[model samples]
Target chain A: MTDPLPTGATIGILGGGQLGRMLSVAAARLGLRTHIYEPGANPPAADVAHAVTTADYTDTDALRAFAQSVDLVTYEFENIPTAALDTVEAIVPIHPNRRALGTSQDRLTEKTFLQELGLTVAPFADVTDAAALEAAIAQIGTPAILKTRRFGYDGKGQARLTSPDDAASALDSLAGAPAVLEGFVSFTAEISVIAARNPQGDIACYDPGENVHRDGILHTTTVPANIPARLRTDAVLLAARILNALDYVGVMGVELFVTPQGLIVNEIAPRVHNSGHWTQNGCTVDQFEQHIRAIAGWPLGDGSRHTDITMENLIGDDMDRVPDLAKDPKCALHLYGKADTKPGRKMGHVNRVTG
Target chain B: MTDPLPTGATIGILGGGQLGRMLSVAAARLGLRTHIYEPGANPPAADVAHAVTTADYTDTDALRAFAQSVDLVTYEFENIPTAALDTVEAIVPIHPNRRALGTSQDRLTEKTFLQELGLTVAPFADVTDAAALEAAIAQIGTPAILKTRRFGYDGKGQARLTSPDDAASALDSLAGAPAVLEGFVSFTAEISVIAARNPQGDIACYDPGENVHRDGILHTTTVPANIPARLRTDAVLLAARILNALDYVGVMGVELFVTPQGLIVNEIAPRVHNSGHWTQNGCTVDQFEQHIRAIAGWPLGDGSRHTDITMENLIGDDMDRVPDLAKDPKCALHLYGKADTKPGRKMGHVNRVTG
Candidate 1:
């Protein structure tokens, strides 16, 4: 096993968003510094990180320099380009590894990986062309969702077919990009387990949180999710299996669908997820710090929930209610330092201790 | 009343130590930026702050430039030279106000202010010379402590008088500097109330934490301090009175001696106190965030504690235990990014939730 990182070591992060901002703060608490590699100017994480390099991922020179500067590399977003990873990996180690990122990046690959692990996933078929999509639609039946095989997030690059009549238009909307046809499952509710694995293979998972969505974006996540004790245990076990199978050394968010037969795998996020934000107030070690600890080769922190919490995201104009939330005794506000609040933009979040 | 600072306003901190580092992280969570002004070349707070100005306090041009760049100014250390403050106050507002600093800067002034407000304080006398020290010792009696009137911290600049014979040596040790002779009180325990007041006159106080000191330095602070309910109430009220008396607009740490008669004010810190560190895990709004909120003119957060916690300071070699502590489920370690660890230096702290 790798030795833990010494204090003051710099950790390189790939994306510069709210997750990176929060991760930077957590890393600083542990006496670790962060160097952010982002293409955009004035990224939120830059405000708190030790250093920031504003260069595109394709810049191998910049990537190599950034990787060489830090002791190890990790990323906030999972969609890093493969070539960029190869360049960074040559100079420094990246946690959650390239395999984890690759599997989660593509819908078809993620489903196949889960099925291979004997975990129940949505019935899915890969579509390389119009003919392939048509054949997959016939096999999967109507009311299936056609999603771009790669790079789809927050409801983007997805087309829903209500019946067989809509399959042709849905396939046409993909613009010839690779796609996946997934048959819908009737889920009672959606829940996620925020789990972490250290370099030593130790695992810890926080209590499942029931997630609610609005306009295809996460709205809120309430811990002590209304699921049976058996299901909760199974959810945690299944998440641990995935982490161990991937040889993951960081936090991962595993979304699951609760159905009559059993829990079905929805998807996985290779970094700290929005659904786990409540851990910041409800647990001794939050998901951001957990991820940092894992990537830095430190022991995984206890992820037990001590307080029942409800986490609500403040998207776009929702920031207007901040003044009132700030005065709330039970609310803990976490605002990302994003200047402009455009529609659908995640501006901040508040975690309220309910019990 | 001054309007609350809008999001994204820059807050200038005068000192760049651990207190400033934690404060900077808290401010960022609220979408506020921090600019650190430190004379030292690689201050710890610089790692997480939005900007840092490395210039001596005596440099009027640098001080002026730093003040003008931020919306408001605050300091982590109380001993900032009055001249530097005068220079900065000309350009930006400084919270906790000038009076709070002036009063707390001198032991004589602080004791006098508490007495004038009808608050109980240790019997004290200003000692200007050897003869005055002898006279004060005679009046205050043996078992007294002679401390410098200004610029003393962490038990430095203090001499203990075990009996009348020790007075001469104690007085001689002062080297003719202004001093205060304080009569010792027989106290069962020491506790501190972390309190805050906003510009709009809103006040909130966290439950007092019982403190233990070793070698005249804080060792641990356990919340839900083993004190009677009535005394806890009195402690909070007394702390609130001190805030009101100062018209304070920031967090203040009020140390008190739990005596048979009543609580005696030991001293007050104009900034966040080390004793309040347990709030990082036990309270919804920790002292650092409360300080930022008050200084920014935001409504004070609920200072109520939800979980019982014990905070232990990692002084010098105590950092060796961090690896083990990191693996503990209940421990939340906070390490200051100071590269070197000298004896008696506070390197970090850990907050453990007991219940």
Candidate 2:
């Protein structure tokens, strides 16, 4: 039997954004310290973390020091470069491992890996060059999406190929980066399963929440998702398969498309995710705290929701409406202390609990 | 109209413990920075706050620097010395006001102030020395309690006078310190109103929660307290009266005894109280976050409980049962991250939501 990990361990997090900010808060509640590493001045997470390293990811010295200071390494986003991970891994354990990062960092690799694991994903083909783009588009057909295999998030670095005329411009839009063409699926809704896996192989998942998006930004997520019980079970099982296959430890968010046929994997986030924010108010264990427990090699927490809940994102200037939102007895508002409300930025969110 | 407070502003917290830890979390969610000013080593709040000052409260230079670094000052505890408040107040605004602190610090002053405000409190008298103790005991009678005038919490610095002989011991036990003799009020139950007062004089009270104490330490708090509508109204009015009297900003916990005659004030916490921990998983706005917002001069939050909730304290070695407690699907656990759990030490607490 493993000796229980004490509470004072430091958790090193890469990507000091809002996700890291929330994660640090969750870690603090469990008596854990968080050291945030980001390559910028005044990232959001810097405000709440115990220690912060404001240096480029390529700063090996800083990375090494951060790794040495922390007991374990986790991340808030999936775009962490291989070199950065390599440096940290040399000194400390990085949960979900480098393979999980490698697989999640690239769209093509993630799809192929999921397919190999017997999970149905959007039909896709790798596009290495102009010829590959044309061939993939021809097979995947019109109205498909052509996206760079790496470094894409919140709809950036991706383009829709609605027609043959849109194909070249779509490929050009990626600026010659390696891409993938994915055939569209007619789905009723999008859902996600936020689950955490411990090193001991224990898995716990918060109920899948149905999500709605506006302009590619998350709008709202409702738990006890309006789906058949079988479909919900399948979504959770698919997440378990992904975690087991990766030997994953830490929280993973598997976004899926709920179609008439069944559930299909859309993407995987090897960290606390936006869709899982509802868990902050809905579940017994929030995704951020769940990730901390997983990486610290502690026992998994209960991941059950005590009530049906809906989480609504307060994007950009929407935070200005907090005063009005406060009037509703059911709303729990969270506003990110971003310096400016730039267009399309996620400022905060509100959780409304329901019976 | 006042211009909106800028996001990313620094908030100075006066105590560094679990309350400040949760406050920091809430502030971060609103995109605000928190700097904790504490006079202790390795405080829990320091683990997550953006900045920390490990200096004595009366250290003027350190207090000046801390005051200058944040937009406003609020505390996690109410026993803060007047000199410390004066030091911070000279440089920055202190929430809940110095008048509130001065009145609440001394039992005699608090009782007199409440009576002057036309609020109901148990009969009490000052006990300065043996002569005064004898006089107070004669008037208040046996079975009264003698407590120090200042600096006491969690049932410390108090002695019960069951008889005239006990009065002398209680008075002598205080070592001739200034004290007060309070006549115990016969009541049915204990409840507290957790509420916030913004700079604009807006007061929002969460529904009262019934409290049960074990060994004078709060053990459980149940929301939507079992009380008549009129009693709940009276409880809220009494709390609002105190906040208005103090011209207080930030959240305050007002403890009361429900007597057959009516309600009587027991005590008041000028900071986030343990009884309000149920809001972490029950209410739309948690008391800590509400306190931060009020102190930061932001608008108060919606104070409502959408679900019935119960909070249970994790005392002493009871923390060893974290795993079992975390396994309960109905429970949400909050650990303080304290290094040791001695007898009567508040290690953590858990909130169980019952819809």
TM-score top scorer? 1
Interface RMSD of 1: 0.7
Alpha-carbon TM-score of each model against the true structure? 0.99, 0.95
Which pairs of residues collide in candidate 1? none
DockQ of each: 0.85, 0.62
In model 1 chain A, where is the ten-residue run with the lowest total lDDT?
Answer: A167-176
Worst 10 residues of 2 chain B by lDDT: B1-10
TM-score of chain B of each: 0.99, 0.97
Candidate 2 Cα errors over 4 Å, as ranges: A353-355, B1-4, B226-229
lDDT tens digits by residue: candidate 2, B1-355? 2433467788899999888888888787666788998889989888778899999988989999999998888888888878888889999888788888888888888899999999899989998888888898889887899999999898988999888899777877888779999997888999999988988888999889999999989999998889999999999999999999899888999999999999999888888899999988776678887887787666777786766889999999888888777667677788888988899999889988777
Candidates' C-alpha lDDT: 0.94, 0.86
Local error of candidate 1 at residue B35 (angstroms): 0.5
lDDT at residue B283 of model 2 (Cα atoms):
65
DockQ score of candidate 2? 0.62
lDDT of 1 by residue, B1-355 (tens): 7788877889999999999999999999999999999999888999999999999999999999999999999999999999999999999999989999999999999999999999999999999987898789878997999999998898998999999899888878878779999999999999999999999999999999999999989999999999999999999999999999999999999999999998999999999999999999989999999999999989888788888999999999998998999989889999998899899999999998788
Would candidate 2 be rated incorrect, acceptable, medium or high by CAPRI criteria? medium
